[model samples]
Target: MSARDAPRPRVHVVHAHSEADSFVTAMKNVIVAEFRDTGHQVTVSDLHAKNFNPVASPRDFLERSDASRLVYPLEQRHGYATGTLAADIHEEIEPVLAADLLVFTFPVYWFGAPAILKGWFDRVLLSGVCYGGKRVYGRGGLAGKRAFSAFSLGAKEGMFGADGIHGELVTGMMRHLFQGTMGYVGLDVVQPFGGYNVPYIAQDKREGLLDELRAVVRNLDDRPVLAVPDLDDFSEKLLPLHENPAVS
Candidate 1:
């Protein structure tokens, strides 16, 4: 390829659910095809289909040197797994480091990411490379890239809103995980694209979601930074105070 043809932006689509026929997986396929159709250099990491090792084993932990201990507990376990994952994990991280944008696709289980995707984060986002020490500012390793989720939630939409049992927007609940983890590592989180009530959603609504997802992908090149708040200054700048009952 010529130099002009060689520098296209790379996109990595990480799919975390298990079943091929599952709604989340199907949604991922839709996303991959859309990204490809746009002519971006795309890569896929199908975590469940690839049988990714979700647990950090004892040997994995022991592989760490003393200096690595100060890093995230998960970071110390790199290159410790045997059999297939010895290669799989390495392959997963390659595209991650190379990609200009990453789209995480998964089903929200128990109000959070599926265990496997979380494990991917635990394993792939490490200290020195992704975060820690004097690098608390955006100067950390992951500063320039972008990361965000396009998730399907199984719960009813109303249950995730204010005054409901869950009492928070799903994204707000997850701000710390992405903002603290990926954000710490330097990925600006683009606004997430989500669909709620998956099991009960109608065929038409599902199609509409797909259309919206494609729109998001089509506009990916233009996404804004969407920078997160600093943790120390977070409560002061963002938190809301309680109103007195006697005020009115």
Candidate 2:
């Protein structure tokens, strides 16, 4: 396809921070705007701003609380409460299914994803569709999709290395969470771009971080990577779907 005729990359950016003024929130806005400027279809799932319901409801129980009747499917009750899941899912899933890239923008809290974003994972990346079913072989339901994460932190960079308080770079900590979990579900992770020391960094340093963030989006791979089976059933491997090294 020609540049204009080529399918524009679709990105589902899930923002997890509660405050708009927070550095992570600001980064989400900037990244969305930049992606849009490049003609990508950007769908922002503002988890907190939407007051997204974090806890799964009765419908998620092994035996759904309500057997009244259903519109989508009986299995959907196992997916999420049709009555209580955030309405945004209706609007979000289409783009998510169509998306070429899925970007999660959030602040790392307690060495993990923010609660709201984690809830999104719990609710949206459901059992039947996103993963786990007779149709799937531990291969993610999102088998062909790609995932990326951009994180912002307020601590000094030195606090994350082998000798630091966390004793791991931000990415190192995210590997299992991102790779083992999300990657296991079929999304190949690109090297994540993280901004550290946000609270103490000077204006120039923050600007530098923004530059790095921009590069991350600009450099996003046009095609997703393929996650295939490894020798063991418990393990899996990923290979870049596209052969062109220049694209990376």
Candidate 3:
């Protein structure tokens, strides 16, 4: 289709940052502005601002399969099948279901995602809804959709390389976030954009990072989706076949 005649994508940004004026928040704002300016619709789930309940407890299910004991995955499957999930969970799922592009923005904490964002995956990406059993990875529920991570870290850029103390950035932190969670759910994940040494960067450099963030947001569709192994690539035992070796 011609560029103008093409359908505009629905972008959903899940922002997880405690401080409203933080670098992570600024990144999210840049994404929103870029997408909106480019004629795409955008929805943001500001987790901290909403005071999202990060804990996945028995309260998540309205009618528990077993009231005496709490088995999270089983309860998640049951709730999804029966439409008995908590109101909050349902609220989170709505935007995701409607989105064509999903983006997660946060500040890396202690070499990992913020606790709240981690909980977001635990709760929002429930069984039988986002993923389950054979319906995972390349065959996941959100297969046709796209997602990405844009995060900032306190550590310097040089520390994330292969020989650096932090190890390879992509295969390290980004892998845990993008490949593990987002890709597992069948969303074609894009390579993450990291704003390294965010806390100590100069204003000029920070502004440059902001510009880069805007560029990424504006060209979301142009980015390549990271390849992930499909269900067919696995043997009956769920192990990878040599022909289509699984990505670590």
**lDDT (Cα, 0-100) at 87 in candidate 1:** 50
Q: For model 3, what is the C-alpha lDDT against the true structure?
A: 0.87
Residue 161 deviation, candidate 3, in Å? 2.1
Give me the runs in candidate 2 sitting further than 4 Å from their true place: 59-88, 133-138, 162-165, 222-248
Report the C-alpha lDDT of model 2 over 13-118, residue by residue, as the tens digit: 8788888788888788778988999998888888887788766554443444355654333344453544444455555566677887788888878777877877
Q: Which candidate should be chosen as best, given lDDT against the real structure?
A: 3
lDDT of 3 by residue, 1-248 (tens): 79989878899999999898888999999988888988988999999999999999989999999898999999998998898999989999889999998999999887778999999999999888788887888888888898988999898888878789878886775677778889999999987899988989799999999999888777766888887876776776667677665532
TM-score of model 2 relative to the true fold? Answer: 0.76
Cα error of candidate 1 at position 248, Å: 41
lDDT winner between candidates 2 and 3: 3
Cα shift from native, residue 186, model 2 (Å): 0.8
- lDDT against the true structure, per candidate, is 0.71, 0.69, 0.87
Error of 1 at 247 (Å): 35
When summed lDDT is taken over every stretch of 10 residues in candidate 3, the lowest stretch is 239-248
Task: Sort the predicted structures by TM-score, highest score first.
Answer: 3, 1, 2
lDDT of 2: 0.69
> Candidate 1, residues 1-248: lDDT per residue as tens digits?
88676888788988998889887887888878987887778888888878888765433343444443434343343433322224555677778889988889998876678899888887776555666554543666677888867899877778866676777753467666666667777788787777888889898998888888888877866765556655444332334323333322
